[model samples]
Target: MHFCTKFLIVITAFCSYSMELKQPIVSYILNKINNSEEGTNSRADPLSKNVEGLEKLLSETEALNQTEKIYTVEHLVKSNGYPIETHYVTTGDGYILRVHRIPSSPKMNASNGKVAFLQHGILCSAADWVITGSEKGLGFLLADAGYDVWMGNARGNTWSRNHTTLNPDKDAKFWKFSFHEIGLYDIPAMIDYALEKTGASSVYYVGHSQGTTAYYVMLSELPAYNSKIKMAANLAPIAFLNHMSPLFQIMSLFEPMGNFLANLIGINEFMPTSNFFKYLIGNKICAEDSVTEYLCTNALFAFCGFDYAQLNKTLLLFIIKYTPAGGSTRQFFHYGQAIHSDKTNILSDLD
Candidate 1:
């Protein structure tokens, strides 16, 4: 057989064997417990708690499940001289988005009224650029430096989880997107809003990692955005995949199988990275009371929130905070496409 034909055979076998686990096992396990209960007087087995690390996992699960713990302006404004305000705008497709606006720094004044808008990659919200580690996040840092700043959360993250006309959870159309749609849709709406809100004609654009990937798609697909975007800076760019992480290497092995499993389930749905994050936070490594535990997920729970609650006080006092919203499978396809094409292109395959 030809080399290409041989490769296909291996991929076919891999796809046939991989297991797809999208359904929540927690609900299933709870149902099993309830079904086995004897009577009103009967209770869950006292020993149920004796399962290896169940209590610890449950506690961590509770912590990880939290949604949207924001760092208040009281914490943000005083620390940095710039005042911060939040904004919400609807997409052309009529999805209402949640965003952040940081006023320009008082130290410098410019007439052009130019500002920078920062965007995050898949499975991430605006908070990824703003919160956690060091007081001046990407958002505040730009604002405090005298450039007005706008931070955006792509659809499906906690904040942008609403629609002008379509509910993402209820409308299949809302979820029908690859980073292609994101680049084509979300970024423009954000730019128009930033310009209108800041009274600027054009703004500087900077995206890190996946953020940069979207920029390339938007620029190539909608050339107009290229003109609107003055100075697009792509950090750690991934237009192609020669330098992909080891994780993607594993994915390459199971791409055929994973694709089959993916189709069997549905679109925009894959094993959420949080399952892994939950595993880390809920296992013995769970340290709700410890600053170290909270920092570990500074990327995931940041959007779900980890501040000011009955949560491990360490989650609250971690002093520094940032949340990395998880990405959908569509984003990964965009990454894969860019890497495969050896240039940035719209995400058309996986949505």
Candidate 2:
């Protein structure tokens, strides 16, 4: 057989195997689409329609016997056969944040005290570092490379939803923070906690997307924090928003109105659970048999530029399950402020 012909044969067989394993999900999504069309009328309230759609999605997810549930950072780390530790660090503003650590791994032997810190993006948790599994995940890679790996969850995310005095649900003050607070408070606390625990003088920092944004804010605003890090590696660093996605542009336009309504209703958190978002983006688009899957995936790549070779279709469902974990409305507004500003700085004034 010709070389190109053999490659095509291998690709065809892999895709066929994937499709066979995903048949249950495809059938579930198809049934949900049909049921949604029949049960929901055009005049139905948007909220009601979304709730119905979310319930159906949840039901189908529960019915899938093959789907493994790994919801939290701890769950993800433990599943990969690595020893994990949970440490809670209290910020200067009294926010208690959860930080996950992989102190030592038997697979790789190196100095036990060398430290490396990993931070997640906006509306994401430490689980983001482990979602790709042990082979490819940066956390696992760092751990295997003999660095004491630590992953920090920002204040408003699912992992760090606690305060010393204020209740996150009842107290608006608990929700009244943005990346500025995260940079100045959360980052320092995590770094200090890791150093104190490991007895290390300086640690290496690695951040992705909003993680990189917060690091910039920290170093710029509090230049003294520069001493705590040995070196920094920024992945997909986002400093300015002069060129934003179409969806973000639309969001920027409505930000003022959204802020006003949030103030009027005393709502400081934006789409905490985001069931509507899950239903619309997670189910409607990522569904295995959906015709619009290509469009939805392309939409994700529109801003960053698509690389089909880098795409991993197999992890789509699990990715959706844990993402949009939660963030304060202030975080969204902060990004909006960045988009509108000419300067590459953290938005100082949220109100």
Candidate 3:
């Protein structure tokens, strides 16, 4: 090819790329607007800029939800559902996620607005709240304390594995949801259901790990749900990605590889070595027999016969059943920045 022709081709490509970038913004203002200049909650646009490092955290959160679980475990225990794993099929172009409701021991009055909704971390199921015989888990404790507690297993988790409109195993649309989508879509649905079931106007929210991240998305993307949230308690929450668990660091490198693996396995959230990965992750959490008993036991915090090793085993089994086959690569990176900063203030975006 002539040198001049080659140069012309390169110039054309560069110009085309620049134009493509500008087109979206121009289209948004001219075509995407509804004469309000308010593009889908302009209030959320700045996303509470004054809240410390939230703006930077949320911009990346939506991306991190796509990343996969780096570590895994081997379940020494087994998978046991309280009432049973329930599926809510929404007619959408994404995976059909599952939800699990943890059963509370007999006495639960909800304590008025004190009912709590427990959202598990990534690769976790509702069982995370009650792995062992101990009832001291946050979910169990809430229930024992006279608060109605309902644990949730999001769409990809083993429990919420069916969809009304998407096939995660075969359809490209099945993997369309990111953690952000959970906040924007699932939380509201869950909240509405919880409210109806409990006959309460509002309920306390307890989110651990990715569970908390999803709440941030809901709080940021759809501010309306914020009003429904009575009080939100974040346990080991990763609002600001800076101070995340060591387990999450590896996700940054693994994020790009997901697409290939999904294509290879014909899925998005499944861990190649799930059994092995579960044990690896189970070790990081509280696993001491004494700790599990004291921590997971009811309000009394009595010994519940759960050994540290058993806890690890239980935790592993829980992970295998819950972690979805496909994680959102884009959402994972979005949250990575927040993990790096370690700022819970990013949580204020929900306010």
Cα lDDT over the full model 2: 0.72
lDDT of 1 by residue, 1-351 (tens): 123223323432332233232543334434534453433324343222344545565565557544423343234543556556778887777767777777665555742366899888666666565454335466656665667878777776656767767765556566656676677788889898888877778889989766777777788778887778778888766566665653353455555555456556766543333433434333322345322232233322322222324344444323223333444565565455444444434344452
The Cα error of candidate 2 at residue 64, in Å, is: 11
Worst 10 residues of 1 by lDDT: 299-308
Cα deviation at 324, candidate 3, in Å, is 8.2
lDDT (Cα atoms) of all candidates against the true structure: 0.56, 0.72, 0.50
Residue lDDT tens for model 3, 217-283: 8888778888888999897766665544333454444544544564566555543224322332222
Candidate 3's TM-score reads 0.55
| Model 1 segments more than 4 A misplaced | 1-49, 56-82, 105-112, 133-136, 170-173, 270-324, 337-351
- Taking all chains together, each candidate's TM-score versus the true structure is 0.65, 0.77, 0.55
- Model 1, residue 80: distance off in Å is 5.6
Can you give the lDDT of residue 288 in candidate 3? 35
Which is the better candidate, 2 or 3, if ranked by lDDT? 2
Better of 1 and 2 by lDDT: 2
Q: Candidate 2 lDDT, tens digit per residue, 1-351?
A: 223223333433333343344444334333444555566444322212455664675566556534434466788888899999999999998999999998877688665567999999887889888889999988998898889999999998888889999998899889888888899899999999999999999999999887988898888888888999899999877787766544455456777777778778987875464443354456655555454354344444433434558877667656766776788887877777666654365436465
- Residue 18 in candidate 3, Cα distance off native in Å: 41
> Clash number for model 1?
15
